[model samples]
Target: GGGGSTTVTTSTDTDLWKDIEAGVTKLLSPAGKVVVDKQSSNVLVTDLPKFLDRIASFLESVEGSVQRQVLIEARILEVTLTGEYQFGLDWGAITQAAALKGASTLSAGKILAQKFAPASGGFQIGVASTDFTALLSVLNSQGELKVISSPKLATLNNQTAVIRAGTDEVFFETRVLETPSLTGTQTSKTVNPRTVTIGVVLGITPQIGADGTVVLHIHPTVTEKRGEAKSAIGDTFPIIDVREADMIVRAREGQVVVIGGLMQEKRINNDSKVPLLGDLPGIGRLFSSTSQEVRKTELVVLLSPTVMVGKKVDEITSRELERLNKTKGRSPW
Candidate 1:
């Protein structure tokens, strides 16, 4: 009767990810000093939440003339689990039936019968050793496994006692669990890419650890002019700055990053037997694995800033607001 249950508590990473992203953004700002490393650079924060709060406030306090816009989003990715177990049984009849279904079989009864002698009469022959071995062999082979139909069953294992009471019926139970969760953010330079778009997206890689410690690897680059500048000046602007700007914006992976975590649970059982423990003709090759199920919940944080290059700050802000209203069918406040 291995029917007891256990559950462990774990910390979530949602807040941790958000704080890190905010902190990094601040470090990249004009006032903040984030020394750029060759190829890529990163900062480790023991006090993550405090650092992120400072950055967020700094961004909010920027001079109104900067014409900046910000966006944020979060979402869940996936949740899953894997489990396995071993089972036991008695009686030659059950073994034979299980064998017909390709299940491993053992003869525990035979072994005990052999070991028992009237001269050594200290114990009663409750079950034979041979039958136990045969049953074990069947269980080990391939087909002795049985699937639990109930997902919320409380007990993983349920064995029937030879002492038959007034009731011949037996009951089995299973474990229950909810789905995992996901959440993160994505940020950009310009809100509208088609008209004045530039941005970056940060995603949290799932199936990591529980500590909420995420690795921040930042790589920044400036694109160079490919073609030699014309020795002779012409009417055309010396360079295609728009195209160059596009290349520059695209070359960088947007300065923003996202983060978050979810909850997960798993259950396994051993030494359990269920009803329908019989064999059916033609179903000899029939086999089934242990029952398990998974579900998921998602969350996300999206952060993006808007900046208009040539337009007046007020005009750009107004037009952008209008565009957002028409596109999203609501105000972005």
Candidate 2:
């Protein structure tokens, strides 16, 4: 009882705790000792009661910080900007409002422009605020804004969360055997059919600060199979167009930051089939009807981050419930 040890078993990023061995040991008594067990991810600390108390407090703080979570509400928008604003979306419109002046209300980091779309170019971050009310109002008033997808999710600090919009394409790889005449002209090659995922995929890894500042590591990727390409030897393969970028930025709680500059032209296809007849492969077309839409639009992402601290979730739910009850003419909580 006079001398003892504490074992701290961690789940993720356990190696990081090992680096602070010196700092933790320094807080102990001269004779106190600490050792990190890599295999078990246990930190053994033998120290006096007073020093152990301090160490426990410190560890709790770090654990709380790391385990913190953030609820992210995202809206993907597409717009068509013309004339003088061809370079990109006019973030300058956001600065016009005195409340959102200086663009400090919005925040993001390193938004890149890709080659898939000619006008896909750079953008400014750090113009976020309570919500996207004003920003959307301004854009909507001037032009039409298409909301692509609205995804709401919660993730632990520094953990990755992915949101996808669109369809999954299934293509089979074919092994082609070609019989060439005496004069060798062309040959076939083995094809490995793979699962190809196409569409807009956004990946985010966010860290929430004590003061509610959210730092996000964002990766956006857009890919589509344009057509088929033929090799010199007559081998055929899918030609894919890919646009992707990685960036980091910071914003405040409930603030919606903007990620723009990705533009794309796509052919959206729709197919309708007759129950029994459409079940056949090659003959399916005879019983099916197909349609296509050609669209040219600029892609924009609106992301709002709300960190869960203390009893914030309860407060939010209470407010929401009260509002809902009022709408139905019921009593408040």
Candidate 3:
């Protein structure tokens, strides 16, 4: 039987074999490669360090873009005051006569003594940004005492004294009842006093430039019934006193601008005596003496604004959040 023989091929140049071996070694080296698994919808990569570095670079770019955006926060305040002043003088001769007639004279020096005598009243209002309604609300809440209290006057008086937007001015009117007096052939006749009105209008303009500087313009107008006179045709005309002014001021954030020295004069009359005699049938007028009082009241307004940006806003927000958490009985984050 013949034996099977295998043929073997061999190359004699060792350097050529070495070159082929080096080429195979280079192909098998640990270079990065991407493999995709279509069935599972997944991406597989071998170079993890380089992939992570690219992701880090992308996140840094996004963070830098976010930092470039900024926000502006601001707070504003408007203040106002309404004053009523009264002045009076004692009728010395009448009081002396009453004293001789066995009647006691009671002297109530001043009406509304505590409110108008010492200092003028003021109001403070604050809001975020240019919220005029909020500021007005504050003023209204604080100025309740200044509202007219006379029933007859209140019926014709304006409920609110503030000047809202769109209208340059507003007016308020009121009517009061006067004391009874003697008339022709009649024991007593009711006298209707002149109708009095107090009207106030306020105008404010704020100009804020790019440099954060603010220019404020304030205009105020006040009108009141001063007196009365008869016309040529037997008609009565009211004498009105009007006061108006314009003011300009420059201010910055968190600063106060005061518009002061606005004045108003009011007149009132009162009668006092020994209780029973003052209310007697016909001689009551003689027993009680009437004294006229005039008052001068001053009004002042204050305005302030605060601006916040970036870190300052953040700090305020954080503090607010903390306060909210405390109110809710929860730990702040």
Best by TM-score: 2
Clashing pairs in 2: 105-127, 105-128, 106-126, 106-127, 106-128, 107-126, 107-127, 107-128, 108-126, 173-193
- Model 3 residue 180 CA deviation in Å: 47
TM-score of each: 0.15, 0.63, 0.35
Ordered list by lDDT, greatest first = 2, 3, 1
Q: After superposition, how far is residue 191 of candidate 2 from its true place, in Å?
A: 7.0
- Evaluate model 1: give its TM-score: 0.15
The all-Cα superposition gives candidate 3 an RMSD in Å to the true structure of 34.5
lDDT of 1 by residue, 51-135 (tens): 4444344334322323221121121112131222111122345446555655343222111112222221111111111222333
Per-residue lDDT of model 3, residues 116-147, tens digit only: 22223322121122222333343344333232
* Candidate that beats the other on TM-score, 1 or 2, i.e. the better one: 2
Candidate 2 lDDT over 1-333, as tens digits, reads 012111111124333454346446555556689987767767788876755766665555555555577788887777765555544566656545524533344334534422233324433344366466666766664446877677788787666888877556655556768787888856776867565556677888776654668878777777677888776656566677777766777777756777776656667798889998998989988999999965556677888898885322223334433443454533212
Which portions of model 3 miss their true places by more than 4 Å? 1-197, 233-236, 305-333
By lDDT, the better pick of 2 and 3 is 2
lDDT of 1 at 225: 21
